[model samples]
Target: MFRYFLNRLGQGVIVLLVLFTITFFLVHALPAGPFQTEKAIPEHIKERMEAYYGLDKPLGVQYVKRLGTLGTADLGASLRLEGRDVSEIISQAFPVSLQLGLVAMGLAICIGIPLGVVAAWKKNTILDYSAMALAMIGICIPAFVIGPVLADRFGQQWQALPAMGWSPLSPSYWLLPAFTLGLVSAAYLSRLTRAGMLETLNQDFVRTARAKGVPEGQILVRHCLRGGLIPAVAYIGPAFAGIISGSLVIESVFAIPGLGTHFVKAIEFGDEPVLTGIGLLFGILIILANIGTDILGAWLNPRLRSSR
Candidate 1:
């Protein structure tokens, strides 16, 4: 297990390195510098700004210099936000994004799993159809559309929640955004879970358990559930990472101050440090989530454990 973990970690590091390399090259290759929009500024001032940012150096030199700061607190100053260090900005913003992501993931799991279970248990019934129908609607609707609809219904029309802005102290700020972020995930999970459960329930072991007079509840909970949940478990890690990265849209809708807001802005302004910092941070999250899921999968399946 220890050796497997180390191997996964090494692979994760390589993935991050590749992600950063691609991001670095793409951003650097953009036609204009951060100061390019300042048309009224003197040529000497632009030259000085370029030199100050080490943009005057050869691409190779700049790449080497930037590589030296990987995994460190020094992410350089923000081109868009003067006097602000990129690392500091990330530290402040990421927690909010992480919190939102976690909540959204929780909602997805809590809602999706039960819907799936019921759909599977009642396979051909009205209840099953209803649950699956709901899941389909959720899957069809995008988060951007859902966000506004939720805000309009729950916030503006109903006056039950805040329409925009974020506050760590108030759970109200989280509701609309969390739901919008989670809805589609919940929909996907529901279908995955139902499929897994149906497959597991059809297995010979389930029949054997039933023949031995194992209680239906016991079979469902202990035997079926364990096997039934495999696909859902595997989907969870990448799903959570998707939820986090996908928050960029929700953040814009809710006006929540998180990494997503800065992420979009970084591209608009060519803020390299912020973009790279966020890229690496999100890469770490995605990599760690996948590793954790692999560990969980190993624990669940003897085949996976032995293979690892």
Candidate 2:
């Protein structure tokens, strides 16, 4: 297990290195510098600015220099937000994003799993059909659309919750945005869980459990559910990675201040520092989440444990 973890960590480091290299050149390759929009800055001043940001250095030299900073946790200042370090900005914003993502994932799991379980247990009955129909609708409707509709119906018309803006640890702020971010995930999770459950129920072990006179509830919970849950657990890492990165449209529509909003703005303004900071942060999150899931799965399943 320790070796497996170390291997995953090493892979994560390599992936981050690749991302850093690509991002460095890609940003530089853009037709303009951070100060390019300022047509008024004279040639000498522009040259000085480029030199100050190490833009004057060769691509390989800049890459090497930046790699040194990365090694020491120095992500540098935002080109757009002068005097502000990229890490500082991320620190302030990440908690809000993390909170939103957690709320969304919580909602997804709470609703999706039970719905899926009921659907599978009920088979082709009304409960199954209704649950599947709901899942289909959730999959069809985009987060952006859902955000406004929820805001309008639940916030504007009903005044049930705050329609926009993040409030630190505020329950009111959690309702709309969390639901919007979670709805699609819930749909997918439900479908996956139902499929996995159905497949596991038909397996020989489940049949053997029944033949051995195991209680139906115990068989379902201890055996069928455990096997069925694996697929949902597998999907959870990426689903969470998506939520943590923020659904750009949902963040925008709902006016949630998060990494997603920051990323889009950074892209629009061509703010390389902020963009790269967020991109690297999100990439790290994805890699970590997957590794964590793998480790957890390995621990849970004897097959994986033995194979490893």
Candidate 3:
């Protein structure tokens, strides 16, 4: 296990390096620097700002310096955020993103697993058809579309939920956004769970348990459901990373002051330092999520454990 963890950590480091290199070149290649905007600054002030942020250095030199900072756990500073340290900005923002993502994941698991289980147990019935249909809608309509519709119907017309804006740790603020995100994700997970559960139910162990006079409910829960969860768990990692990264679009739509919104604004304004910081943070998130998925997979599957 230690060896496996070390190997994954090493690979994550390599992935981070590649991301940094790509982000550096991409930011530098933009037509305008961070100082350039619709309203131009005085030439002297722009020059001094460039020099202070190392934007005046050759791209290669700036790349090396920025890369070196990562070794010492330094994320530099955000030019767009008025001299706030890059790490500080990320630290402040990560928790909000994390909270949103976690809430969505929890909701997805709660709703998706049960929907799937019920659908599988009642295959070919109304319940199964309804669950599958709902899942299809989820897959077809993304959260971006659902968010506005939900706000309009639930918030605007009904005036039950808040229309927009984040209120930080307030359930009222997070409830709509989190549900919008989770519901869309859960739709796909529900289908996957239903399929996996159906397959597991057909397996010989399930049959043997039934033959041995195991209670139907006990067989379904102890044997079929547990086995089925393996596949759903496999998807959780990538789904989680996607939610975190994709939150940018949702946050923009909802006017939430999360990392997603901050990152989006930075990109739009060509804020190199802020954009790079956000990119690096997102890249690390993806890598770590993938690593965590691998570890969890090995733990859940004895075959994987033995092979490793």
Candidate 4:
């Protein structure tokens, strides 16, 4: 297991390096300065600014410098936001994104798994049809549309929750945004769960368990659920990375000060450091999540552990 973990970690490092290299060049290739302003600065001032940020250096030199900074775990300062480091911005924003993501993921797992299990168990029934139809609707509707409609209905028309903004101190502030993200994720999870459950239920082991007169619920829970959850576990890794990065539209609609908001602003303003920092962070999160998924998958499937 230690050797396996080391191998995965090495692979993750290689992936991050590749991701950083591509993003660095692509961001620099864009046709503008990171410090572009509505009012033009004097040429000398601009030159000084460029030199201050080491943008005056050759591209290769800048690239090497960026790698050096990354080696020391320094994200450097945000070009657009005076005196603010990329690390500081990320530190401030990530907690909100994490909270929102955790709530959403929890809701998705809690609701989607049960719905999918029931639908699979009662295949060809009204309950199955209704659950699937709901999942379809959830999948078809985009988060941007759902978020505004939810805000309007619950925040404006009904006055059940605030229309926008997040308050960490208040649990009420969490519900709308969490639901907006969770419902969409749940749709995908439910379908995957149902498919996995159906396949597992038809397996030889499941047949043997039934033949041996195992209680139906115990067979479903103990014998089938672990295998049935494999697909969902696979999906959850990347899905979770996406959620923790924050939903762009959901954050905008809810006026949440999360990583997604910073990411968008960084792009719009051509803040290269911030953009690359967030991209690097995202890559790290995705790689870590995948590693976790692999570990969990091995635990759930004894065959995987033996093969490893």
TM-score of each: 0.95, 0.92, 0.94, 0.94
Report the Cα lDDT for residue 56, model 2. Answer: 88
The TM-score of predicted model 2 comes to 0.92
Score candidate 4 by lDDT: 0.88
- Error of model 3, residue 210, in angstroms: 1.8
> Which model scores highest in TM-score?
1
lDDT of 1 by residue, 1-308 (tens): 78989988999889988988899889988887677775577989989998988989998898888888775657788998989999899989999998999999999999999899889989999988999999999999999999999898999998999999999889999988998999998998999999999999999999999999999889989998888888889999999999999998799988999998999988888889889889988898889889989988887887998776
lDDT of 4 by residue, 216-284 (tens): 999889988999999888888888887776576688889999988988888777788898898888899
Instruction: Report the error of model 4 at residue 231, Å.
Output: 1.5
Query: Root-mean-square deviation of each candidate, in angstroms?
Result: 1.6, 2.0, 1.6, 1.6
| Model 3 Cα lDDT, one tens digit per residue, 1-308 | 77877988898889878888888788778787677888979999999988988889887898888888878888777778886887788788878888888888888889888998999999999999999999888889889999998888888899888878877757887878888888877987898889889999999988888898999888888788767877788888888888888788878777877888778777776777677778878887888887788778887677877776
Name the runs in model 2 displaced over 4 angstroms. 211-215
Clashes of each: 0, 0, 0, 0
Please give the lDDT score for candidate 1: 0.90
Residue pairs with backbone atoms closer than 3 Å in model 2 (clashes): none
Alpha carbon lDDT of residue 160, candidate 4?
95
lDDT of each: 0.90, 0.85, 0.83, 0.88
Show model 3 residue runs off by greater than 4 Å.
none
